[model samples]
Structures are given as C-alpha cells and as structure tokens.
Target: MRIRATVVAAVSGALALSALAAPAAQASDDAVSRADIAKVREAAHAASSSKAAFSARAAAYDEPYALNVTFSNFKIAKAVKVGTTNRVTAKVTYTLTHGTDVDITAFDFLTDPFLYKGSFAAPQNVLIGDDFGHCKSTSATKATCSGTIDIRPRDYELLNADAGTWKAGAWAIAFNGEDPGADDFDMGKVGYAEKGGLATTLVQRYSKLTVNASPEPVKKGKTITVTGKLTRANWEAFRYAGYTNQSVKLQFRKKNSNTYTTIKTVKTNSTGNLKTTVKASVDGYYRYNFEGTTTTPAVKAAGDFVDVK
Candidate 1:
C-alpha cells in the first residue's frame, strides 16, 4: 500500500547575495545592515549547507555548541488534505565546530512528526514513520552536500512540542543522524542543535513547489492516465539515491483556479518511483501540477509537464 506525505507549513528566510553585508565581530551586538544580510545570504547559497551528504570518518566535536543554519525560499507547493499527506521545501545552510566526538555522519534530510516524552534536559524526539514522513539515506554526510529536510503534513506537531504557545513565525527542526554506535555522533541532536548553528527560536517561511498540469488542447477532457517523473538534477549521487521517500501528490488546477486541489496521492514503490495518476476534469488550456517538498536532495520543480487529449 502507498502512504501519503506529511505537509509542512511554516515561515522562514533564505540567502540572497547583495553588497550590503559589512564584516563585524562575531561578539559584536551591532545592528545587521542589508549588505551584511546579503553577504550571509550569499554564503548560504554558495555552501548549500542544508542538503544531506555521506561521511565514513569525518571530523567530530562536543561542548560549546556551534551551528549557523539559514533557510530561505520557504513555500508550500501542495497543501495536504484533511486525511492525505503532502511535502514542503526550504533552503538550509550552516557551520559547526569539528572534533573527534563530532563524528560528521550522514543523514536523511526528510522531516517528520516526533513525540517527546523526555524532560527538557534530556528531551527525546521520535519520528512516527507510519506515513511518508522523515525518510532519507542512512549514509549521508557533510562532505557530500548540504542537507534538505522533508517534513510530512503531520510533522508540524513535532516542531510545536516543548513550547507553551504556537507563535505565527516560530518553528523548530530536528536532524536525525545516520550513526548508531555508542561512540558515534547522535543524529537527532546534531540535526536540531549541533549540526546547524540556529537559535532555539527558529522560523521558516512558506514557498511553492510548482507542478505543471496541463491537458491536451486537442483532446480536451480526455481520460488518459497521466504519469509524472521527478528527479534531482543538481545533487550528489549518494544524496540522490539515498532519499527513500519519493511519494508525491498529483493535483490539477483549472484555467482560473486560485488554489491547487489534490486529485490523487501516491507513495514511491521500493524501486524509487514517485508515480501517481489522476483523471482530467478540465478541457482546453488546463494546468497539470504536482506539489511536494523534502530535505534530502531538495527537488525544486516537479520534473516537466505533459499534454493530454
């Protein structure tokens, strides 16, 4: 059986290169100028620090935590229904201290809903893998590429936990590492706190993942089975094949519809296929689209579009 993807809805910012950033001491409390913000944004774009990677014996670290994570281009391509699942995407970047205990392991950047039963000193976030939530590669590392986390529609619950109120722009992200040994670095801790130097009060904005949906102009209102293919064009090999969760929701928007309505949703089979089918409801000049998001090898667009008749 195929499972639905989790839907993520949040607000966050990303890197944008401009000539407004001025070098200031890390310890200084001066106001951040537009130029400084642009420089930081440029660095975030250059490093691609948010994507996932694989590492065998990379550096490790401990103690005074250090991670600088920035997420931009936040959007919700296809929002999840009351019962089905969906995906969300965002750009991420970060910097951390390297050491022996700081085993820079690999991880899947997918996001999922987690339950915390531990106290503040020892909080525990567990991903409920029932749906297409929080699925990624186990061999991901920092040496490969920046990581992207895919959160399901229900994963927002995990981000909202441990807080008293749910603010409009406040959110949290947890990274689950690929290491399992006692001496290895903790994936969950590294992802949330150690891996990306972000404030405990983090925020993410919503962006759109456009899926082209169009019907054959000649064969208006045709009932053909439409198949769409999604692939990572600008990602490393390990990061590309490591993302086990490729499920997607196929949707359609009529000539003048304002919102995307979900027509069908499907989970990728074991062979890495995020395939789904839907019947055409509109005639000529219709739009066919798919809405999805993830962290591992973040996919920008839903491949290409097709014409139906």
Candidate 2:
C-alpha cells in the first residue's frame, strides 16, 4: 500500500555535497581509502629504527606520528537513518589545528573525518567520504575542514550489524608530494595522525507510515473506518517490510482545530497492518503516529481529511 515517507532529520555543521562523488582522477578510490588508515597505522608501529624507510609493500613501518596536529569541534547528527535503496549522505565538519611548520593546504596533504563500528586501533569496519575533505586555513596554524559521509545500504561496506551506534574518527596524512602508491617509497617522507571515539551517533533503519480514513461523506454518528500500515527498511531483504506488533496511535483533529487528539491506540497486525473503526463526529482529519524505537526514527502519517455530512 502507498504511504507517506517518514521525514529524515539529520543535522550537521553543514550539509554534505550533492551528487555521488566519482572515483578520484589521481588514484583509485579504493586504493587510497580502503586501506590507507590501517596501512598508515601499520607502518607507524611496525617499522624498526634500523630501516631507512618502509617500501611499497607497506610492511615494517616507521613514520613519525603527527603529534603536532589535533582535531576538535566535530559536528554530526544525533541519528542517521537509511533506507534500503537510497544513498544517504551527511555533512561532517571538524576543526584541525597543527604546528606552524605544517602546510595543511598542500594539494596532496590529506586530513578527513570518518566513522567506525569497532576498535579504533583495529576497526572491523570504517566509512570514509567518497571524496577527500576540503580544508581552508582559518589561521596560520588552524583550519576548518568539511567532508561528506556517504552511506549506501546496498554496498559491501555496510553489514546488518553495522546499524547501531558508530564512533567518530579523524585521520591525517602528510604525503609531502610523495607517491604513497609507488612500488617503493621512503616512509620517512610521510607523516600521519589519527584519533577515534570523538563522539557517537546512531545509524538506524528508515521508517514509513501511512494512514487513511474512509466513508468520506459519511453521516454524522456513522461508523468511520481507519486503516494504515507501519513498515521499516529491511537491509537484509532490501525492501520495506511490515513492522508488526507495534503500538501506533490513531489521532484526530476537528476540521477547524490545529491540534490532533488521540482517538485510540492500536497495534499493527502480523503484516504490519492497522485497522479500527470509530463513530463519525464532525468534519476533521485522521492520522497515525509511531513514537519510534532505538533502531528506527519516529514518524507520522499525513492526516487524511474526511468530510462528515
């Protein structure tokens, strides 16, 4: 049955860039994002004092940690709701401060924020922007940067278990114009920095609700039937399925009244369908409201206006 789409509320310092970012022209998107952070961390800790620098293998590393840099003032929405087929994007912003000697605006230098589902040092999964962050220096030693957090429920990057709370993280790389993808490079030329768990937010299933009141020209005091269905995005099946056995409120407003009063509370059936009957009183509107749960955001159906003759 057709229903109203649940309104998605996401807040950030700024909205993410529109249009899905295509793979970067300089390098393969996956080659840089999928393994860059982990590989950087690997080289930072794995390298011994004896080695001149880690080679292309990215094994046995020793790159000086970017102790001079730090991140703060991060802003993200309290919740991120995703549907089965649509791509969800949220703007992420953070403040970056570094020593004066660092040229953060250099073309190849990279600093961006991301989200992770597990341990920061060894995360089970990570989500980064399809494009790199855009940083404009605010001062000699500070800059404000913004980037997009692109989410596609259908991608391999997303697993059903990844739906709960996710931790905020930021990382930086001072490639110094060195080719990180080169067969062999001097790791000493590169610098890295990262921090995790700066903040937390929920990633929830998108919800949809629909309501309809019938017997449009009903006589006063006659029976008026109300019907609706409650459903939430199912990542596993890539569809919206019935959200059964959930409490939903049937609300009514007099034709001239601005407020909606609760007429009755009903539970969705096995198929996420809701049905009930009420005596027609005056001309007004009918709607259904779901308060929502931890895994889904609250939603309200558009009021269906009915005329009582």
lDDT of each: 0.30, 0.71
Cα deviation of 41 in candidate 1 (Å)?
Answer: 28
- List residue ranges in candidate 2 displaced over 4 A: 1-38, 45-64, 121-124
Query: Candidate 2 — worst ten consecutive residues by lDDT sum?
Result: 4-13
- Alpha carbon lDDT at 98, candidate 1: 28
| Top-scoring candidate (TM-score) | 2
Quote each prediction's TM-score. 0.28, 0.80
lDDT of 2 at 80: 89
lDDT per residue as tens, model 1, 59-85: 123211123222222222222111113
lDDT of 2 at 271: 96
Candidate 2 at 238: error in angstroms? 1.4
The all-Cα superposition gives candidate 2 an RMSD in Å to the true structure of 8.3
Off by over 4 Å in 1: 1-215, 218-221, 232-243, 284-294, 297-309
